[model samples]
Target: MGGVSETHQMAPRPRRRRRPYRLAAALLVLLGLAGYYLVQNESTGGDGAPHCTVVAGGDAGGSYSMNLEQARYAATIAAVGTARKMPERAVTIAMATAMQESALRNLDHGDRDSLGLFQQRPSQGWGTPAQIMDPVYSAGIFYDRLKEDVPDYADLPLTVAAQKVQRSGFPDAYAKHEPDAALLAAAFTGRAPGALSCSGPLPQDTGDATRVKAELVKVFGSALAPKAGPPASRVAAQQAPADDSEVTLSVSGKDYQGPADQRRGWELANWTVAHAAELGVQRVSYGSKAWIAGKNKGRWIDKAPGKSGDGDPRNAGPDDVRIFVAPLNR
Candidate 1:
């Protein structure tokens, strides 16, 4: 064959281009993933939806039944911090106090007609009966005091700070509820977002410790437990105690009967858990039944004879669902 001239030998035509469909498809997938994450973070819109549970008590027509609802609602609003802006430690302290004070209820009565979740006594001018009943308003007042008190009282014991504002009959009552409060704060503050959850009768927010534990497992996984048995060092517990206030929120009867109320309970629980360390909570428990070492399903249990319900004998009964907090040093 005769040798072709260099100019005559044309380069192979460039490969024909295909449509940009593949590139467009990849971009759409990326956008979809981003949106999903945003929703999960509850950043796409207002404070996002609350993740809460229900806690029933009494024969369904008693003080406990009524109080449970209040407690649940209190937990939800306390967790709010303007979307992701909430602090984990702050939420924890809120939970601890809620556990100790009113068992999370915004009650109308106390030692001297104390009102709202903190048991703000009308005698002491905490608030009027009507104002205390408003979850949002009540939570705001509590936070205001907390913000001021917590700054200087950061190193103080959980009970100590609580007592400064509460002036409770027993200053040490808040100490016990610290542990679980911390756990709930961690979950609610978005530090452990999606970590707090409920199971069993999801519809009923009974303060069952068993169900609380189950929710902990659902959120934090089995790794929440240490390789060894429960820790023995109080200081260690204080340093890094296992958060156990698994019952973030419980909408039993009066307080959180509606969906809005239930959502509010979840927010408070999450906030408390997220701020556990800051609030000085080490562990948390709720419902009529405390967490059964290793069980699920919270049953109605009476308070111990001497212990009293959450330390208040007047508050004790099979009907009441008490919230137990952990020690400061764990």
Candidate 2:
């Protein structure tokens, strides 16, 4: 028998050996791209929208930040608490709840038909989707429930108090946001002057006295009259600014009294601060303290003893909260 020719065919070498190198290179490219975007976002605030900072007690007590929309909602929440005469603690609880519920963004949707900043459920008697979507109305409802259901909420632990009003599946999640909420409350409630500020280019809208009055009515449910003017004068003042480059709104002390009055003043002042970007507010003065947008790096600075209201050399009295609005670009 001829030598049996048995040839063994070798299996083709697998191509798997090169795949790891290619994958590693691709991962490096992805990582580089991610890092580049992160840096860019940090530097320019991503989309160029204005940014707000809530500092706790003059930058020593830590801080938290959110975009313009979140800041606006937070201000509304605080304003509602003030309007309801709820204590700062109540505002803190509401803010913390909103922070956990929707990250302070008024949502048009939520878990199982829940909606708005508080994630209140329409199916559970919260409100119609339209009403719940209104920040002012929603905030009012939250305060009403908090007051009606948890009367002693101010004295209770934040989580416990919030859980009572929310009845959330993750009841304990609220606790994690207390620190941030407290900081925001301090600024929004006017417990901490100059505690909040917004930076970057102002919004495109140039706010005027009329817009200021309108916004005040929208949030506090009443028009804010000038301290020195009659109703007719107030109306005339709201018509248009003499300079057209600037406008001012004054809060009168006649309507408020005692410590609660002071709280309300701060609330209005802080509300102005919160809306500074949107309203084109250049400066806000209450008592002797003033917060100038983009001044001293957007911190509250002391106004001279006799200088307030656009450097008029007259005191902005304790009973008055004066807001000066200027062109955003200016």
* Local lDDT at 242 for model 2: 62
Which candidate number has the best lDDT? 2
For model 1, state the Cα shift of residue 133 in Å: 1.3
* Clash numbers, per candidate: 50, 0
Give per-model TM-scores: 0.40, 0.73
Superpose all Cα atoms of candidate 2 onto the true structure and report the RMSD in Å to 1 decimal. 7.3
Question: Candidate 1 on 77-157: residue-level lDDT in tens?
Answer: 444432223355555666678777777766767776777676775566657778776655566666677677567556677
- After the best TM-score superposition of candidate 1, give how far the Cα of residue 29 lies from its true spot, in angstroms: 57
Q: What is the C-alpha RMSD of each candidate to the true structure, in Å?
A: 19.6, 7.3
Question: Which portions of model 1 miss their true places by more than 4 Å?
Answer: 1-71, 81-86, 199-330
lDDT of every predicted structure (CA atoms): 0.45, 0.74
Q: Which stretches of candidate 2 lie over 4 Å from their true place?
A: 1-49, 58-60, 203-205, 223-240, 243-262, 308-315, 328-330
Candidate 2: 10-residue stretch with minimal lDDT: 230-239
